[model samples]
Each structure stands twice: as structure tokens, then as C-alpha cells.
Target: MSVERDILAKNDREANANRREFSRLGIFALNLVSSPGSGKTTLLVETIGRLGGELPITVIEGDQQTSNDAERIRATGAKAVQVNTGKGCHLDAHMVGHALERLAPAADSVVMIENVGNLVCPSAFDLGEAHKVVVLSVTEGEDKPLKYPDMFAAADLMILNKCDLLPHLAFDAALVEANARRVNPAIEILRLSATTGEGMDAWLAWIRGGAVEARRRRAAAAPRAQGCACAEAAAKA
Candidate 1:
């Protein structure tokens, strides 16, 4: 128990530092987490297609092996860095920080980190993101939220992906949402099908809103940053 706590404490410290750097660079980072077949990559591809040119967006793909996800992201004309975690089940703050260094995402841009597909380990690790967006497909059991309460609780937004499959599946969308709310009442949920482009407008709108807010924050901090630089120069002189 002590060892686990210590490891998490260290990870949190690094995550805080990463957050500071991200804020300084005006990057709106989001950690996307879910089970292996939750369609996270497809959602990202669609998202990039819709907002890539309008807003500078970059991606950091984490997987046990292969750069397939990163390749898909790149195909949409977005800069992406693939982090092969090997045997690791999650992407920690340190890994994301290094990926950020390599990607050097544009200022006031959105940095989406697609974490290794797992509903468990990723919940315990913070990747210095503005929010953790968890994707849950309708094909998965409706009781997943109850089973993986920690993941739902940690997520800021719950994306119900593959909604197009709802017609063929016996999954109960309402029950799933209720379960998710039971675990995380404050979590905002969005239903969308990346393949069919259904409910995509809302998702795109949310992304746009986040990006706008990030830019606003950066603009608000610019004057203070400039003043600090001027003061430092005067002191040196």
C-alpha cells in the first residue's frame, strides 16, 4: 500500500509540472481513455477532420505496440506522435511530457492523448490533461460504469460512441447513462457515432468551446507574462 501510494504521489508531482508547462504554452490537452474496442481512434479521426484546419490540433497515441493509431491520426492531416508503451497498461505524465516535447504542438492548440485501451490503469494516472474523456461504446455492457466506477468517476466527459449500433444491440443507453451518473453525477455525456457522423455537431461544438476558452486564457495571461519579462530585464540591467 505504501509503495503504491508513493508511486502515485510521484506521478502526480510530474503531472502537475506537465500541467504548468501546458498552461504556459496555452495547450488544451485531453486524455482520451477507454476499453480496447471503444472506437476512440475513429472518433479522433472524425474530430480532426471537422476541426483540424479551424483549430490547431495534435495527437499523442499510446498503445502497447504498433503505430497504427498514430498513422490514422496523421492521415487526417494532424500532427501525431506515437508512444509505444510496450507492456505498460497506461500512459503516465512522464511519457506524455516526452511526447509533448517531440510533438511541440502549436500554442493555443488542442493536444489529445489517446491512452492505451484500458478502463483500469489509466484512471489512476493523470496525463496533465485539461480533462479525461472516457469513451464507452454501446456494444459494451451497460453495467460497465458500475464495474469500472473509478474510470467513470475520473472522467470529465463520457462519450457514448458507436451509437449507430444501438439499433442492433440490446444495450440500454439510458441504463448505461444512469449507471455512469450514479458513479459520476457531474460527468457530461455525449452520444455520437464516429462512423455515421451522428451527434457529431455537439461533440465538435464542445471541442470548439474548449479551444476558445483555452485561447481566452492564453490571451488573458499574455500581459502578465510580458510584464514579468520586462521586470526581469530591468533587474538584470
Candidate 2:
């Protein structure tokens, strides 16, 4: 237990440093967490397609073992890096930190990481992301938040994917949204079907929202940093 704690502590420190590095480079990172078959990849592809021309985007896909997701993203005409964590249940900040160095982003670029499909463990580690988007498919049942509270609780945004299949799957979109809000009052939820593109406008809008906000925040912050630097220089004089 002590050894495990030590490892986690080290990883946490590394994650914080990774956050600072990403911020300095002006990369808005987003970590996607979900269960297997929860449409993480599909959503990622759609996101890249939607935002491809709007902003420079790259992907880092985490899996226990598979180059499949990376290959899929590559097919979509976006740069992709695959992180295969053998036997690991989740991705930590350390893995993300190492991957970031390998795929350094230009200022104001986006790094979208699709975490290995599991709701629990990934929530424990922050990958220096602008936000953690949790994807829940209609096929996964409406009671998922009840089953996996931690992931739902940690997410900044909730994406209810596969809404095109809502009629077939009997997935209650209402209940899912309600329970998610119950668990995370602060979470913003969107319903979309990445497969048929139904309700995609909302998802695309949210992605654009982030990019726009990041650009705005960067624009807002630049003068403040510059002002501080000038003040410090004047003090030195």
C-alpha cells in the first residue's frame, strides 16, 4: 500500500508539472473518459472533422493494447499518437506528460486524449486538460452515472452519444441527463449521435465553444502577462 501511495504521489506531482508545461505552451488539452464501446473514438473522429479547419488539432489515444484508435484518427486526416499502456487499467498524468513531450503542441493548439475505456480509475488522474469530457452511449443504459459515480462526478462536460439509437435501445435520455446533473451539478450535458450525425450540431458547437473560449482566454491573458513583465522591468530600473 505504501509503495502504491508513493507511486501515485509521484504521478500527481508529474501531472501538475505537465499542466504548467501545457499552459505555458498554450495547448488546451482535453481528456475523454468512458467505458468500452461508449463511442469515445467515434466522437473524437467527428470532433476532429468538425474542428479540423477551425484550429490545429492532434490526438493521443490510450489503450491497454491497440494501435486501432490511432489508425482510425489518422484516417480522419489528423495527427495522432497512440499510447498503449500494457495491462494498465487507466492513464495517469505521467503517461500523458511523456506523450506531450513527444508530440509537442504549438501555441493555442488542441490536444485531445481519449483515455482507455473505464470510468473509475481515469478520473483520479488529471492529464493537464482544459476539461474532461465523459461520453456515455445510449446502448450503455441510463443508469451508468449511478454505477460509476466517480467518472460522472469528475467530468466537466457530459456527452450523451448514440442518441440516434435512443428509440431502438430504449435508453432514457431524460433520466441520464437528470441523474448526471444530480451527481454533478456543475456539468454541462449534450446529447448527440456520433454515428448518424443526429444532434451533432450541439456537440460541434461545444467543441467550437472550447476553442473560441481558449482563444479568448489567451487573448485576455496575453496583455496581463505583458503588463506584469513591463512592471517588473520598470522596478528593476
Top lDDT model: 1
Q: After superposition, how far is residue 212 of candidate 2 from its true place, in Å?
A: 2.4
Candidate 2 local lDDT, 1-237, one digit each (tens): 344456467777887897777676667788999999989998889878887887788999999997999999999998888999999988888888888877776778788999999988999887778889999988887889988999999999999888888778766789999899889989999888888888888877777777667767777878899999999999999
TM-score, per-candidate, Cα-based:
0.95, 0.89
lDDT (Cα) of model 1: 0.94
Question: Best candidate per TM-score, number?
Answer: 1
The window of 10 residues in a row where model 1 has the poorest summed lDDT is: 1-10
Task: Please list the C-alpha lDDT of all candidates, in the order they appear.
Answer: 0.94, 0.86
| Shift of residue 78 alpha carbon in model 1, Å | 1.0
Listed per candidate, the RMSD to the true structure in angstroms reads 2.1, 2.9
Compose the digit string of candidate 1's lDDT tens values, residues 1-237. 444457488789889988988888788889999999999999999999988888889999999999999999999989999999999999999998899899998888999999999999999998889999999999899999999999999999999999999999999999999999999999999999999999999999998888888878888999999999999999999
For model 2, name the residue pairs that clash.
none
